[model samples]
Target: MSRKVIGIVMNGVTGRMGYRQHLVRSILAIREQGGLPLADGRTLWPEPILVGRNAHKLKEIAEQHGLEHWTTSLDEALAHPLAEIYFDAQVTTAREHAIRAAIAAGKHVYTEKPTAETLDSALELARLARDAGVCNGAVQDKLFLPGLLKLKRLVDSGFFGRILSVRGEFGYWVFEGDWQAAQRPSWNYRTQDGGGMILDMFPHWRYVLDNLIAPVQSVYAHTATHIPERVDEQGRTYPATADDAAYGIFELAGGVTAQINSSWAVRVDRDELVEFQIDGTHGSAVAGLRNCRFQHRAATPKPVWNPDLPATESFRSQWQQVPDNGEFDNGFKVQWELFLHHVASGTAYHWDLLEGAKGVQLAELGLRSAAEGRRLDVPELTL
Candidate 1:
């Protein structure tokens, strides 16, 4: 089999998501497996050049991985002719400028969600990439999760006859950083740093709802700063200027309604950190990050509301667990493989920069709906 090496310039490799998901689990894992094998007996090996502001950290990561390339200068890395792909997992506020530069430098760009801080900037990036005729993509990793994949299978198989509504609960109690250090970055609570539940999570919900359920037509949302204060990384206290929680109601194209509650202040009481309960006319299903459960009309028990008598029916026990029929890879890694294939073989990839812009548009409108105390229409972004 013929082998080809694809040089990828990966920025923000020191960040949590970047380091863990994109670099270690995805790219490094692929390298360890001898790269991705194409259908035509060709292998595409990924050679990543770690880039960041901290030279010491970058050097450490490169040395640990036995990778020869590491650089503190982004421009110098981008100028490398072999580095055809530029991947970003940086802070949301810094994404636009870096991506624009990558596109201008004639490199394929792929990045994490909320491609830009605002819809306009996100759209500009999309247009710029299109004008430059470069292949670009954004991370929509949740779609490949095991639970969501099962949910999609059910939807595709018509398990839920005449789908009605979807409810999503996503969050875990983030430590206040007073006694224990916060699990999330301090910037996640500061508005100036492109922090807030709406900006951070709405993009995810937008893609999820649009792809799995239906196209979102409008949204009504309410946001709050449940925890007003938190300590920073250096044990310094600061006011939490961004919304810690958001409750939103979305109207889908086919009269389907979706309610999603995203919060960092809420404690976990469910099966996973994130779960979606979908109810329909014929059946109902609840999907977590790794598992999914379903109850059809034939198996659903009749339970009458009773205030005086003790309830005998076990509602949770009624739903049957969906069995895993196939091996599942890491969600991030699956997308990475697909992106690599697209770059190597000109494969068809639907998730482009325009789709990323739609995510930003939904976030911008969701925040607007929260501030205005009204349901705001989501207009289609055409370009």
Candidate 2:
């Protein structure tokens, strides 16, 4: 079978997510699998070149990963004849400049979410890519998760009829970088670095809602930086300028109210990175990042929600762990292969750049709402 050589110019490959998720797992894993099969009996694998500002880090990563090509100069790498795709996982604040350069180089572009920090910048990038006639996309990894897949199945099967609402609990206690290693990048705690819970994650909910439940039509949000002070990698305390916690209420077209509580301040008291409760008239379902369970009205114990109830285990047992049914892969990696398949074959990927922009749009509106202290209308966009 013929194979398309897809050379990927990857910027910020030395960063945690850039190296781990995009480089080693997505790109190298595709090479390890002998490329993804196309619809027309063809195959495609990313010939990835690591690009970053840190020479030592880039060299070490490439050496450890058995990738021969690495470059500190992004311009030089972009000039390579074989580089058809340019990817960026740089810091959120720096993403636009790199992606804009890639678009100028006539390469198809993909990057991690919050396409740009501002709505206008994101929309402008979309316009540039569209005018250039090149494909572009951003990472919306959660929609491809296994647990979400199960949740999607339950929702599609009418298990959650007359869906009432969805409540999301996400985050664990992040390290303060004083004694223990910080769980996230230091920039995430600073607003100047394009860091904040709302900007970082509202996009995930946008696509998840748009695809699975309802398109977000309006938003009312509140945000805060609970920990006013944070210790950096050098153990120097800095004033936290970003909102580490976000509370958002979204109104969908279907009247399915969705509430999200995102944080970097809370300690985990649950079994998952994200837990969702979806209650419907016919039944209700709860799903996490790893497991899914449900309860139907048939299984209910026939008790009304009371103000003075102590405890009950009847409805609890009805919710059981979803069985393992198929081979599982990293959510981001799965989406990457889907993108390759769509590019090499007639098959198409469900998530695209426009969908990615929709996510960013939600975040943008969310910020506006938080700032103005009022609900904001999300203007619809066209492809």
Candidate 3:
């Protein structure tokens, strides 16, 4: 019945993802719910100290949230005596240094993925966090999605029975900023800003595959910059130097082959913007961000491949929708609560800096595979 206030140094809240998902939907939501309930009949209340390069934006967000602390100086925020955790959701290029500083300051760290631009730097961050003995974690929120959770349940129930393959389709057309305002930031299309489809998405695929299906063993990829130019927020034209699309084939540890296509130029044709279809010997399932449908081997439709005849059966109707047995909260919020609990009670958290480094490794190997036009084996990292 007592409450313990935990100060968290929240950096990069000015960015879109940082503002919406991590700050508003997760941390602030938890605060509105009377903090996170601990097992010892106490509440772990989170008080975030917003930090970023944009002093105006930081001040604005702090005022809007009715928060008392907002600072442009990371040093000042880190030096706060109550600051137990440092959370980063900044642009990829700016993440490593801030995290290093946080580790050196002896604060527990949590961050969004692509922990560093390269595998070496990412591993170094992991090593530093390990050596510092801080409770560190990287965001892997996709694993907490309702559809993926249901898919994991099916897998755990042996419904897949000798899983065979996975096919993932993720992307939607991002408008060229000149004609229509782009949904994503212009930095996402620039190579120098640590942006590209491979770097942005391969890390996600890494964790999803390793945790839900099997560990990735190798990868073959091809990437392209479909749009050559785009306008920035200031209405100035800039060359798009990063890949907008990436097609990859991954081999998993259990011999499962996963083919994924990520693109910003392709229009969405599926039920959701992102979907993964997993096939196994006994059954097959298609899972979107919110829904999952499955077809047993016996119920699968058989279609004739005659080009002359008209198709008669409804292929989509043959699958059964998976029932939602429980209410699902926001995935980001769920992870935030878990990480908070880990800090408060020494709970075991699997998605550590090492797991995040694996993601960076996948992205680096994927890019190399695309450049060399050859399959690259993913070597395990030790630290």
Count of clashes in candidate 3: 0
Off by over 4 Å in 2: 304-315
Estimate every model's Cα lDDT from 0 to 1.
0.94, 0.84, 0.95
The numbered model that scores best in lDDT is 3
lDDT (10s digit) by residue, model 3, range 1-383? 99999999999899999999999999999999999999999999999999999899999999999999989999999998789999999999999999999999999999999899999999999999999999999999999999999999899999988999999999999999988899999999999999999999999999999999999999999999999999999999999999999999999998999999999999988899999999999999999889999999998888889889888888999999999999999999999999999999999899999999999999999999999999999988889
Clashes of 2: 0
RMSD of each: 0.7, 1.7, 0.7
**What's the ranking of the predictions by lDDT, best on top?**
3, 1, 2
Worst 10 residues of 2 by lDDT: 341-350
- Over the full model, what C-alpha lDDT does candidate 1 score relative to the true structure? 0.94
lDDT of 1 by residue, 1-383 (tens): 88998899999999999999999999999999999998789999999988999999999999998999989988999988679999999999888999999999999999999999999899999999999999999999999999999999999989999999999999999999998889999999999999999999999999999999899999999999999999999999999999999999999999999999999999899999999999999999999999999999999898999999999988899999999999999999999999999988899998899999999998999889999999999998988
